[model samples]
Target: MTNKAVLYRMVMDDHLCPYGLKSKDLLEREGYEVEDHHLTRRDEVDAFKAEHGVETTPQTFIDGRRIGGYDDLRAYFDKRVQDEDDTSYQPVIAIFSVAALMALSISWAAIGDLLTLRAFEWFVAISMCFLAVQKLQDLESFSTMFLNYDLLARRWVPYGKVYPFGEAAAGILMLSGSLVWLSAPIALFIGTVGAVSVFKAVYVDKRELKCACVGGNSNVPLGFVSLTENLMMMAMGIWMPIRQFVL
Candidate 1:
């Protein structure tokens, strides 16, 4: 006997339900023949929800048993469900992974080598830009979280708000290998402050707090990863000037 599933999801003129598409795709992937039902109109959606006693669209059923929504379906399939407040390194991992790939690609294209000093430099610079972008997404939230652990931000509240922009500026300048005078100091100053703050917060105070490295809303723990970010910046800051004037 063939396994079968039923899925009801909204498909409106203005908006298509993403979870509905995911549900259909998942069912097919799991070797289930899906009986897909589209509730295209608002009234139809409402009626379907009322009839099934469900609160949301993209409802799924397997073997004549209600399987709830997308998250429920994932749980049914023994997949990890994402929780907003859960402490996860996924965001930082993704940023660093992409940055590494980008750096390697650039090195290959430019210098005909995958692993070069240039590649490492680019990796750090790109990672900085990506991390800064995350914080820039919601500056207010970032500043609020930053002030919790950053000594400078605590004393000077506006420093938290300005940090993302400063990081981005330093990253861009470093990437282009320009304005060593400006970029180097910016990177060094922020990196030094950040390293000290993270060390004090996590080591000295032994406070358990979230890292604002990825973003304010990130669940990444405030510890080694955060310290590494600052250390990388400090390294880049010191290296760039020497590489330019000395080597």
Candidate 2:
């Protein structure tokens, strides 16, 4: 006799409980026979809820033992579920990865080569523009969060409000291959301030905080990604001027 698990889920005309499907799949994958129960109508769902005193659908039962919800079932099987509030590098990784690919694609299309110094400059510029877009989406929220650790922003709150605009302007100017005199200095000053702020907040003070690099709602840490963003700006700032004037 196979070990049997029961899954109660909604499969109504307009609704199908995703957790219920997941519960059934998990049980079958774990070598258990699944007895799937669908509450296909409102009254049936209501009765099921009343009988179990549960407020939601997709309740699971294993060998007559109840496992609460999707998260609970995962816990019962010693599996880990990502929490909503957990800090993750996923957002930053996704942004940089896509930006790098875009830079390569654009460089290849424009100049007929993927491997060139100009491509690197485009990569940095595109990255700045992308990050600036995030901040610009919610300037009020971004500035509020940015003031927490940015040295210049903390001293002069107006700077935090202007940071995203400056970033966008520099990036756009660099991308157009014009106005290096203006873009380079702006990038350098902001990048220098940002680098010092991140170093102080994360390394010197040993403080744990979220980075505003991607916006106010970001979960990226106030360390490596933040520092890298600043360093990229600084390198682009110094390189653009030299390339235009000397190289």
Candidate 3:
């Protein structure tokens, strides 16, 4: 008995299928002797597809049995099929989680008891600062992407450049528990603008875009997560003013 696999993939001059390369690599990595077959011409590819009764390219066969495409090959090896352009919530989750924990720890150490509301406020403040830092890291890239859907940034270009600084300032002021008058209004205005922009872009206009919240390089989708950040800021903005004036 021979441990052999056959890979039928397209390798045309203008079009080379990535899945085919991945399939070939996977077979080689798994210690199989791969018999490589290339469908270089359009007619050859079309004929192969029609003959195999398959819709897509990069078809694999092992031990005289069909193994399908790249995704199917992964399933054969019990590996997770990765989506290359998929957006993730990991960055947001990590930042918010760390911010919340830090806030809780600080509140506990300072007051000798867990001040839930105060900790929540700190979480929002810290999260804003962390997000602002990400934006500030690559201001030009962040601002360019931000202008795509942000109402203020689209209308007034300088607002995109100033946003990160304003966000950081408000977050720091809130964290210090002072200058509530300045921080509150700034937080409220930005938050409201952000929420509205996200809503219109994602829901109303149905535009699929990346969020500039985490950074310019982030692959986070511009939707629920972005809106949540804005809502948190708005809530904190309202809460801070009331806490300062009333209690």
Candidate 4:
């Protein structure tokens, strides 16, 4: 009779207890009609699904293309996102990986010119350590987003499981090199690992995520400079072998 209006399968955070209610409260505040599954009767929901062919939940459809769930919904809040079913994504972390490497490279020469070689070594090593930790944080964000919750998070593959450990290993090595008089074998191995780590992460992984690596409130695509930076980092990793022998 009335076009049988409907919406389904959106966010399921158990009242946002794990992270905070801010996400839910903010969504609600935005005039989005949210339906928490825990609040509804199971039988009624099943029946509604059967009646309306409701195949997806926490699903936000602006003019019809399914935008997945909470995360997608948030993404949609940005006008640039055209519609749901849109999966072309880039993460800031990707860009950061590149930028970080470039900074290290340029700083390598500048720090050398300005300070003692030993001092510059410390700066590079410590900078990588911090960046590695930053990558780990991004990993955590990916973990939360990829978990089987109320909607799309379940559909897309989880990525951090493939990358964080390697990055962490790199950080540990670089930090070690920075901190003390380590063997060339160890220093070279770690540096190589860091470089290879970023490359594997960038090219091997599928581009399904929002790239939360940008390290702030902004969400932007990982640019070409970022890609070039990763390549350079990969080279640096290779250079570690030489550095270990020489420096």
Candidate 5:
């Protein structure tokens, strides 16, 4: 037994007190030390926030990594909790987004032909509205992102807060691409963010290997190339700004 141990830091939330007690109990059961930081003062909270740079309450700092609030705490202690979303809804979400993208992206040309402004608008609408699936998950869905990277990509996977959070922000851009006016600006911005995400996933990630995004994409058959294919979509995204939403 090491004399110095890493403590699981549980910062209490008024709504999530059960989480704290559950964490404390689970830690004891697991033989890890637990430290409870029931923060009530703004100064104390600020100090903790400065150490971790997190804005939410009910945060957990485990071995210098912030485990985030309640949902995360539940995911940690209970396998059933985490698997609940993955086994249950990931496929459904994928199906919804896939169908929306395909139905719109395919029939889009029939609307006015690809080169025409109306047809172009339909593509943008498909992509943006289709991203509604993203709102189904938060930064937590890919909690396994880092772990899945190293084993599959064959390199060190970075564990950081920014990547998943960036995905959340990208969700907004996905929605923004629908508008006639804001579409151009938001499309450019979304593509740039996407490029950065790819760089991180490929060069910065372990082995530049692609992770399985969704099983069959409902019926879309998204294979290994699908990951690379999105990069091309990033290329296609450039056309979005071309029309420039002239009113």
Candidate 6:
């Protein structure tokens, strides 16, 4: 016997329900023949909701049993459901993984090697840019989180706001191998301050807190990953000047 499911979702002229699409896709993927229903008009949606006594759209019914929405369907299949407030390293892991892949691709294209010194440099530089972008997404939130442990930001509130911009500028300059004079100092200063701050917060003070490395809203812990970010910045800051002037 073939498995079958039914789904009711919003598909209006102005807006389509994303969860509805996801529900349909999931059912199809799970070998279920879906009877899809679109509630296009507001009144139709309201009427359906009233009839079903449901508070939301994109509801699913499997094997003649109500399976709720996307989350519920996932739960029914024993899949992990994401909670926004949950602490996770997923974001950081994704960023670093992508950055490493990009660095390798660039190195292969430019130097005909996948594992060159240039690739390593680019990996760190790209990672910095990615992290900076995260912080820049919501400066207010980033600054607020940053002030929690950053020594300089605590004393100078504006420093927290300015940090993402500085990190971005330094990363870009380092990646392009341009204006060593400016990039090195910016990286060095921020990296030093960051390393010290993270060390004090996580180690010296033994305070447990979220890392603002990825962003203010990040759930990444304030320890190894955060310290590594600062250390990488410091290494790049020092290496760039020496590589340009010395080697």
**1-247 per-residue lDDT for model 6 (tens digits):** 7899999999999999999999999989989999999999999999999998999989999878898989999999899998877788888999999999999999999999999999999998899999999999999999999999999999999999999999999999988999999999999999999999999999999998998988888988889889999999999999999999999
| Stretches of candidate 3 exceeding 4 Å from the true structure | 1-77, 81-84
In terms of lDDT, the poorest run of 10 residues in model 6 is 82-91
lDDT (0 to 1) per candidate: 0.94, 0.91, 0.93, 0.43, 0.46, 0.94
RMSD of each candidate? Answer: 1.8, 2.7, 7.6, 11.6, 14.9, 1.8
In each prediction, how many residue pairs overlap at the backbone (N, C-alpha, C within less than 3 A)? 0, 0, 0, 9, 0, 0
Largest TM-score belongs to which candidate?
1
Off by over 4 Å in 2: 1-4, 10-36, 39-47
Assess every candidate by TM-score.
0.92, 0.85, 0.69, 0.36, 0.33, 0.91
- Model 3 scores what on Cα lDDT? 0.93
Residue-level lDDT of model 4, residues 39-134, one tens digit each, is: 144565467557656543444444446555455556767634344444333443454455455556655665644344434344444444554465
How do the residues 1-247 of candidate 3 rate in per-residue lDDT, one tens digit apiece? 5578999999999999999999999999988889999999999999999999999989999989999999999999999876868888889999999998999998898777676788888889999999999999999999999999999988899999999999999999999989999999999999999999999999999999999999888899999999999998998889998999998
Q: Candidate 5 versus the native: TM-score?
A: 0.33
Which ten contiguous residues of candidate 4 have the minimum total lDDT? 1-10
lDDT of 2 by residue, 1-247 (tens): 7988888999988988888888888888888888888899999989999999999988999878888888898898899888877788887888788888888999899999998788889889988999999999999989999998999998899998899999999999999889999999999999999999999999999999999999999887889889999999999999999999998
**Candidate 5, position 237, lDDT:** 50
Tens-digit lDDT string for candidate 1 (1-247): 7899999999989989999999999889999999999888999998988998989989999878999999999999999998877898889999999999999999999999999999999999999999999999999999999999999999999999999999999999988889988999999999999999999999999999999998888999999999999999999999999999999
Note the residue pairs that clash in candidate 5: none
Q: For model 6, how big is the CA root-mean-square deviation?
A: 1.8
What is the model-wide C-alpha lDDT for candidate 1?
Answer: 0.94
Between candidates 1 and 6, which one is better according to TM-score? 1
Flag regions of model 4 displaced more than 4 Å.
Answer: 1-39, 59-173, 178-247
* Models ranked on TM-score: 1, 6, 2, 3, 4, 5
Which pairs clash (backbone N, Cα, C closer than 3 Å) in model 3? none
Candidate 4 to truth, TM = 0.36
Error of 3 at 229 (Å): 0.5
